[model samples]
Target: MPRETPRSSRVGSRIQRVLGQVISADIRDSRLGLSTVTDVEVTKDLSAARVYISALGDREAAGQAVEVLNERAPYLRHRVAQAMSLRHTPSLRFMPDYSQADSDRIRSLLNSGPAGEADNKE
Candidate 1:
């Protein structure tokens, strides 16, 4: 049988959806361009949220994007609260999601073929 997700998880999912939309459409930070909200984890008490974000650009751009997001976190939180119908919206904490980068590296390793394959091809 499949395991059921907890109520907190459900609430966190909804909060993530609202936050993603609000941050993408409402938040205006030129420094942060073409950012994607990968995931959001809200605390059980709805006090804080870890917002995972991925950017489509170079390292410098990603760094700047994170800085901008951090600077505007308060505004983003307010926007989320406005968009969501929650009694206590969690505080937003922006974090660069490096899972995509890690996945890409793993894919590259797999695509490079087996280790010492050429050496073994005597």
Candidate 2:
């Protein structure tokens, strides 16, 4: 028999999907900008999950959106548990995903050249 996938992984995926839907459709907070569920990490015991989110905005706006999401985590968790029918609802922890920002910064640096060469050319 083949080894089965881990329960935590399955639950994490479900949570990510449900949370994304809920945030986009149900959340009415203005502070919550165009947010995307980047990733979710659930504990082995299925007791907690760290949800990474990215939003289309500046750093301050992203921070505000994350704060709003964290504030609404309990409601989101309940909705997710109901949707998945899980025995134990994992506590949701909202985290801002800065990978996109980092990548953008790296791309800008690469395109700008090592020093002033690109500026001089322009």
Instruction: Say which candidate scores most in TM-score.
Output: 2
| Per-residue lDDT over 50-118 for candidate 2, one digit per residue giving the tens place of the 0 to 100 score | 899888866777788899999998899889988998788989999899888778888998986779675
Residue-by-residue lDDT tens digits, candidate 1, 50-95: 7878877655566677788888888888877887788887888888
lDDT of 1: 0.76
Alpha-carbon TM-score of each model against the true structure = 0.77, 0.88
Off by over 4 Å in 1: 1-5, 28-30, 57-62, 119-122
> TM-score for model 2?
0.88
Task: Give the local distance difference test score of model 2.
Answer: 0.86
